[model samples]
Target: MVAGRLSRYFGRRFLGASLTVFVGVFGLVLLVDYIELMRRSAGEANASALLAAGISVTRVPQIMERIMPFAVLVGAMLCYLNLSRRLELVVARSAGMSAWQFVAPAVIAALLVGVIATAVYNPIAATLQEQSKRLEDRAFNNAAQSGLQATGTGFWVRQRSVDGQSIINAASSTDQGVRLGGVTVFMYDLAGRFVERIEAKAAVLEEGYWRLVEARRYPVDAPPEKLADHQLKTNLTLAQVRETFATPETVSFWDLPFFIEMADHAGLAAAGYRLQYQKLISRPALLAAMVLVAAAFSLRFFRFGGVQKMVLSGIVAGFLLYVLSKVTEDLSKAELMHPAAAAWLPVFIGVLTGLVPLLYLEDG
Candidate 1:
């Protein structure tokens, strides 16, 4: 009963501190982004305060999502620091509860945070970002009257074949990015001559190529040829197509499976979505590891005379973790490593590194 009570107490404290940090960080992001957006809109006649606020609100969530791990780290640190200052942790240790035992609640809290972030917060952020984009388009152009169009929605891609270099413009695409609409492909010859342009009503990625429907080929100095079906030879895979437009952040965890299925059907690579899904699933574990890391630094006695130093060290360690994570993600995207391994390695390293030191400190 005592153990359970202590765990609950610490968990509540950690959660409260985490919430405080969450609000503070988001509030700061909102203030900064709103001010910047408002300033940038100074010369635009249509830009208004409300629209700027909307963009800031939409953008802040995703920015907050990126900082969540750091929040957990700092929140847990604050929780432990406050307890240490009060000698609560010392008393708990004296009473036979190890640091790890007392930190269990914080671990659980971080796990819950991770779950909510993945399932609930992500979708909300994605929707808000899309709405923000639409608002920008309407404010700058006459899109509201004609309806918002998808002309510049996704990334543009270029591919080379013996036939020529092909520049692809897809007005819109599914999250899987294999199915495209309003696609225009401009083909050029090796000597930089215009060969022909193929405009397709829609395109579906097929194995090693693209299957275009309702395609029209417009040759230079010739009449356009209408074709019921067209095939464009592509060295690009489904995975490559997916990367060209749908960044991992834009796709939600719940929708990743659907995207995977679509890519699989198209015989394209779904590595990006697969990696993102794995990362989302691994988030709870990663946050739990963060708590352990924070605890390892903050559980020392208040009289140790280096509390600030310890805090600084913890901050540096967190920074290193973030930098290494970015490096690994780039490597995974470049196919230098398996996506699953890239996604989980940092979390694995964090847990082990944090746990080992704490275990030694407490048990030794």
Candidate 2:
């Protein structure tokens, strides 16, 4: 009965502190992002303050997800420190509860939070992130004349059919590349000889074909021909295009496996998707490790000296973990490291780093 009551009490304290920290960080991030978006959209006629705020609201979730580990670390530290300061931990210790015994509740809570964040919060954040991009694109639609110039030069796809081969380029695209603007296509013969060029105001991906709008076709041996609409043959699908255009962060954790398979079928690299999936898989363990780290730094009684140094050390440890994760992510994206290794290496290191000091402090 006593153990159960203590566990409940500790869990409540840890969760309350974590929630407070999470909300505080979320609000600050939202405010800063809103201001930045407002400033960027100042010259955009369609971008209002409300629209900017909406975009920021959508974008902040993904940002929060990225920094969640830090929040957990800080919150755990605060919780433990407060308990120690109030002599609650000292009393618990006097009652024969080990540091691990009290810290176990927080670790379990952190694990549950990580699982929920990965399985539930991630999907919602991804959907909102996609919506945020769409809103930003629409608001800035007229900011640049060249659709390509406006949207970071767009994308290119090569398709082949019985008629021969074609290279398609677009200045901008939407609906996961289903609709394209400022479109250009270069045609080649079976002999790989340049044959024709087509410029279109827009192109829509259709069943085994491209529906080009307001198109002008230039032939190598004949005069250029204009057509209001043209049907070009190709071999591509909606899934392939969508997978091509979707970023790693915009795909939900649940959808990542399907996306990775689709990319494989489309002959595209799915390293990013694989990395994301692995990261999500390791998130629970990572959060639990953060609790250990916090306990290591904050479990010292208030009467102990070097409290400030310990707090600073906890902050620095959290920052180093963040940096390490980013470095490994980049290495994974560049194909220099395996996705699983990149995703789990930091977690492994963090766990060990937290466990060493903890074992010494508790056992020695």
Candidate 3:
């Protein structure tokens, strides 16, 4: 009964600390993002404070998802350190409780938190992220742009049809690239000769063609003609269009499997999505490993001294883990490593890094 109570107490402390840190970080990110948005929209007449705030509120969740692991690490460390200072850990240790025994609750809690973050929080963030994009577009009048937007470099697609080939560009796109804004299409013949150019305000992918709206056709040898609507032949499908704009971060964890399968069926590379799915799968283990890391650094008896040094080491170790994850992520994105390997290598290394020290401290 006492042991169970201790476990609950430790779990509650860890969760409380983590929640406090997470909220602090969220507010900081929201404030910084709002200020940046405000600065960017300073000269725009259509931009409003409410729009910027809404965008920041929606976007901060995705950013927070990335920060969750760090919060767990810091919170766990603080929880352990505080317990050590209060002699709670000392009493627990004196009661024949092993460090692992006391730490198990926190580890379990962290794993549950990771699962919740990946399953529930991710979908909400993805939906909000999409909304944030729409609000940003509305605030900046991005749909009315005459050329490619400065951010993201927009999207480009190439199509070859029986008639000829065309290179399509858009300043902005939505609905997974099914709809495009500030569109331009350049046509060329089989012999690579310049054919014509079509500039449109918008384009939508249809059953068998691209429906361009408010378009101007400039023929190679004749005068430009304005057309209210024009249909351009194409052979691209919805899957291909989705591949062009569905970045991995913007995709929900629950939907990643379907996307991966679609990309596979379409013979398109889905490395980013594959990596993201694997990352979410490994999140629980990664967060559990972080608990071990925190325990390793913060479990020293309060009277043993060197507490500051241990705290610094913990911070440095956490930063190194973040850097390692990023390095492996880049390698995965570049296709230099398999997505599963890239997603799990850092996690494996983290577990080892934390477990080795704890094993030494506890058993040796």
Candidate 4:
């Protein structure tokens, strides 16, 4: 009964700390986003505060996505610091509880946050991101230039074709970005007349050429009746196709597989999507690692001189972990690293490094 009570107490403590951290961090993010929006609107003939506020609110989800790790760090720090300040940790230790036992609630909380983040927050963020793009289009009057809009219909991209001109509309892409689907390849000659149109059910981006499938070819000089289905040959490669469909963040974890398959069918490179897929599977471990990293810093609160120093150290550690994770992601996208390794390496390193302090403070 006493153990149950202790668990509940710790759980409540951790929950309160996490909530406080989230609110504080979110407020700061809102301020920064609002300021940036204001700066961008300056010197414009007219500005809409209401529009800016709505856009800023929409931007919150994206900012929150980036802020979650820091939130974990700060929240964990607060939980530990509070316990240490009240000597609750010492009392727990005296009662035969180890550092690990004291940290268990926080760790569980972090895991819950991770699950929620993957299943709920990420999808919401994806939606907000798409909305943000629409809002930007409304602001600029150029829907075509709007970037990274998420959709269940699959990823879409518009780009200029090679030879320095012409627009290509690709409804979907695959193979890390080497194939395209529902492709409409349009070209205009120097005379400003539509010179050619190539519509393909799919296009494969090979080494130096795009091989169109179920294609229809149209020549401006030819009679409409003369237009015929023909396999196409073009100089665009898989890499170039990938460049057009590059924002992997707009797709949710649950939707990545379908997107990847669509890309594969369209003959585009799916490497980035593939990497993101592997990363999502490893998220539980990553969450556990964040908890462990936090515990490592906070475990020494009794021995450390000041709570501020511990908090500072935790922030620095979190930043380094973030940087390492980004580097690994880049490596994975470039195909220079294994997808699993790139996704999990930071977590592995953080957990392993964190273990030393945990063991010393708790087990020893």
Question: Which structure among the candidates has the greatest lDDT?
Answer: 3
Give TM per candidate.
0.77, 0.89, 0.92, 0.74
**All candidates' lDDT scores?**
0.79, 0.86, 0.87, 0.69
Task: Let me know the TM-score candidate 3 reaches against the reference structure.
Answer: 0.92
Predicted structure 2: lDDT? 0.86
Candidate 2 lDDT over 1-364, as tens digits, reads: 7667888899999999989999999999999999888888889888899888887898899999998998899999999999998999888887788878888999999999999999999999988876776677677663123222323566788889998999988876665577777788999999999999999987888998889988999999999999999999877878887787667777899999999998887678999999999999999989998998899888988897789999999899988988999999999999999999999999998888788988998998
- Candidate 1 lDDT at 117 equals 89
Q: Where does candidate 1 have its weakest 10-residue lDDT segment? A: 141-150
Q: What is the C-alpha RMSD of each candidate to the true structure, in Å?
A: 6.9, 3.0, 2.6, 8.7
lDDT of 3 by residue, 1-364 (tens): 7888899999999999999999999999999999999999999888999989998998899999899999999999999999999999989988778988778999999999989988999999988887777777778876644222425666778889998899998887665677788889999999888899999988989998999999999999999999999999999888777676677887899889989998888777789899999999999989998888888889998899999999899888888999999999999989999989988888888888888888898898
Off by over 4 Å in 3: 143-153, 160-162, 189-193, 206-214
lDDT of 4 by residue, 237-311 (tens): 444454456567767778777778877887876778888777777676676777778878876656557757766
